[model samples]
Target: MLFFLRMRWHWIVVTTCAFLAIAGTYLLTAEPTFVASTQLVIFPQVSGSEAQRAFAEDAFIEGQLEIARSSDVVGGTVAALDLVHDPEFVDQTPSLQDRAKNWLTGFSSGNGANEVQAQTEEERLHDWATAKLLNMTGIRRIGSSTIIEVSAAASTPQKAVDIADTLARQYIQKNIAMKANAARQYSDWLSTFISEQQRGLADTASALASFTSNPRDQFKLAELQSATDARRSLYENTLNQLTETKQRITYSMSDATIVSPATLPLSKARPRSTLIAAFAAAVGLGAGLALAMIRHASDRRLVRPHQIAETGGLPFVTLLATAKRTRNGHPPRFLAVGTGSSTTARPVIPGMAELSATVVGLRRKRRVVIGVVAVEPGGGASTIACELAVLSSVSGAKTLLIDAAAQKSSLSKAIAPQSSSGLADVLDNGELIETAALPLSPTLKFLPLGRVDTVSPAIRLSSRRTQLSFVELKKEFDSVFVDISAFSASPDANAIAPELDGVLVVASHGRTSIDDAMRVIETLRNVGAEILGAIINHAPKSMQP
Candidate 1:
């Protein structure tokens, strides 16, 4: 959360895009609607036709509502009325008028693939707008009021009015025309049948009159009467069917009753940008947190030495290493004792001071020569060697800090500016080792890793030199500290460990793997070297304190 809050720009960009997308959709996609409305009340027109009229009215009202959605109504309205020309509302054909005419004539039916071509320009346009514009809404009304309601929407106010009025007029005209046609057709058919029946009756009467003279058969008279009664029943049924069809058509088309006309709506309906932006921010925050957790999981680097100390229950002596630079940038972040400083990079911070004091407490003697070695060369062995010498000499006793690592010239570079002779010259060439030791303070002296040309490194730490140096050291120095190269990677520890009181292996925090440390321990053990204890060198502040 803190990291997210700090990255304000991320939130801003996400929220802005959300806001624009939502706001733009609303502005571009939303349509404004205007509605117009009028009312109608239905009542009986004839004294004898009251029941029929009521039935017609009821059915007609339902028909009108349904017709509003039919192709005839929508097509006719679009063809007759002028509306905005939008791509979604137009046919793909070049001839707009023909398209409109065909639509109005009920030639096109909107369907799959017919989405653009199935409808004429006018029909397509009207259908495209029907859900948005003209809606019969309902044939609803106030209680006890026979008024039927109508509603619609369009780009222009006048168009809304035109649609409402035209729809009502067309519906009424269609209904009246249907009722008139049905009545006329029924009346014509009835007249023709009545005339034919009259002619037949005359002939039958004449025949009967002739038969009566001969005293006609009784079964024939009965059969004639039955036929006459059947005809009458058939006539009645036909009359009823014709009447009902007409009444239904009339009721459906009537304009004498209306509930309300549709009117224009003042506002467009759709998206809220702020709401979208808020939701986007929430999603972005979640994404950021997930990313942070993933990064945290992927980091595979060792950090504190306490991880081993707590788990292994081993005491670690913190050592400072002489800082060196490899070809890699800034030497790895793992062991940062002091940067690029070949001099004394080691220091007695509070924790180390207390730790060193404790280490002295566990020892049996004050003049212990602790050889500082590590699993690797850059693990602050020289730094530990220097600081340990400082700490020992700081007690007002004579002390000598020796650099045992020959491959690296960090000590030579550091002490050459002050000392004229070095340990290498003394070991291999029998050069005077006493005059060149640098006095950093009253009791402390630093020996440079000096020139070695005559003798091999293996022989320098041999029992012969050990005896020679110890014999010389007892005369002037109370304690000596040997800083060796990585004994685990090189063979120096095995060669020199026998000459020293004990070997102190220095492992860097966050750099040396546990396997590497164990190997160094094993190597010292294999070499018959005395393992005094392990030292954690060049550790970060948090790891120390």
Candidate 2:
């Protein structure tokens, strides 16, 4: 999270904009909906046995809740509201393809067929309205209670209220009708059973009368009398049940009652602007964090001195700030060692003295020849080389600044643009090296690349004569600072690398990638060049370590 906040906070605005766009679109396109709800309480009927009633109550309430959401209740509500004819409830406009198809059907069909089709279409519309109403309705039991909530949502407050009230009323009427129908069915079955019992009772009574009249067999007469009594008792019990069932059919009412009627809603329930905007903002924040992390993970620029050291397997020197340009547009100078005066036009970098000390400590002998090179161009290698040479000269060492980079000698142009003879003239044309060397200060001497044609310096620097020249120059000067071309641009640095005492690689912060720096390190190691350490140049103040 901190990484995102510190390194990639800009992503937040992008994500916020995206989320705002989506929310704005929804606000403009979506219709506001209002919701109204009605509550109903179910009471247990008193007709059944105690155990039967307890189980029945639970099952009954559950069944009713399901029925509230069922197609029957929805269809009844649709019929009561005449939703089939309402444009808001049913989409009357057909698509172009559908209109064309309908036209073709009417054109090909006879009048009778068209009438049948019209009836079918009406039925389809009715079914569609019922389905649509069901989608807009919600039914649920309120916790562990017999009460059920029926809610409806629509585009208008009145429509929502009407649908909710009408649905509850229809459910109540349907429940009453079901109970009455059940009682009537039981009464009808009882009536048929009573008729059968009456016939049986009459037959048994007739048999008993015959037995009693004959009086020949007492046991048979007793058996016939007992059978008649049993039949009469059974018929009386059935008659009592039939009377009770008939009374129930006449008196039974619906088990459910409306506890709260739906009222017109005061406000729309959905698409609340405040809630939607807050939610969109939250989503935007999360998306921004995700994008920031992704970008941070994929970034390859080296920003710290330790990162370059760890990546290239080299020791870290010191961080150097990007130099200010002089009036002539030359790179700035480093702080001179032990110089209390700050009269130089170029700004003094803070860590250049430390960098010079570290380089000086790496020297095994008094006269040290250090070549400065970079992994890629624009790494501030020339500026760093010039600064180090100045610092060494100010420290009272006889320092010679050598411009070995042939293609673009930034150091040569900055220090000695008008010099007719330089390292390039000496190496390519066998000119005297002493004539090319120019003195910048009593202790500091400068050697530029001088004028040359298309030939690359890598070829001239690779010669045995140039190698011997470096040996002789190292003896003449206490310290020789060679500014070489970037390793990626040419192999001139590598060609003269073996002749130098050590090489200091300069990497620009946020410009040189770890992969490129590591490649330069590997190439130098392959040539057996002694690597002293790497210096990070042109680092931002915030990035200094």
Candidate achieving the largest lDDT: 2
Runs of candidate 1 with Cα error greater than 4 angstroms are 1-350, 362-366, 428-431, 454-459, 463-468, 538-540
Clashing pairs in 2: none
* Model 1 TM-score, 2 decimals: 0.49
lDDT of 1 at 28: 64
lDDT of 2 by residue, 1-545 (tens): 55347557778778988998899899889999999999999986545888887788888888888777777778999999999998777897878997887778889997877788789888889999998888888999898788999999999999999999999999987887778889899989989998999999999998888778879988888888888999999999999998988887788777889999999989888889889989999999899888977877886777666676776677765678777777776654532223443322333665777888887775535688899998888888888888788878777788888887876788777666677877767775545676777766778878888776776554576667552366777778889898999988887877878777889988877677877877787888788788888877887665444
The lowest-lDDT stretch of 10 consecutive residues in candidate 1 is: 329-338
Highest TM-score, which number? 2
Any idea what lDDT model 2 has? 0.80
Instruction: Name the regions of candidate 2 deviating beyond 4 angstroms.
Output: 1-35, 47-52, 81-104, 155-159, 176-254, 263-351, 409-423, 426-448, 464-468, 508-515, 536-543
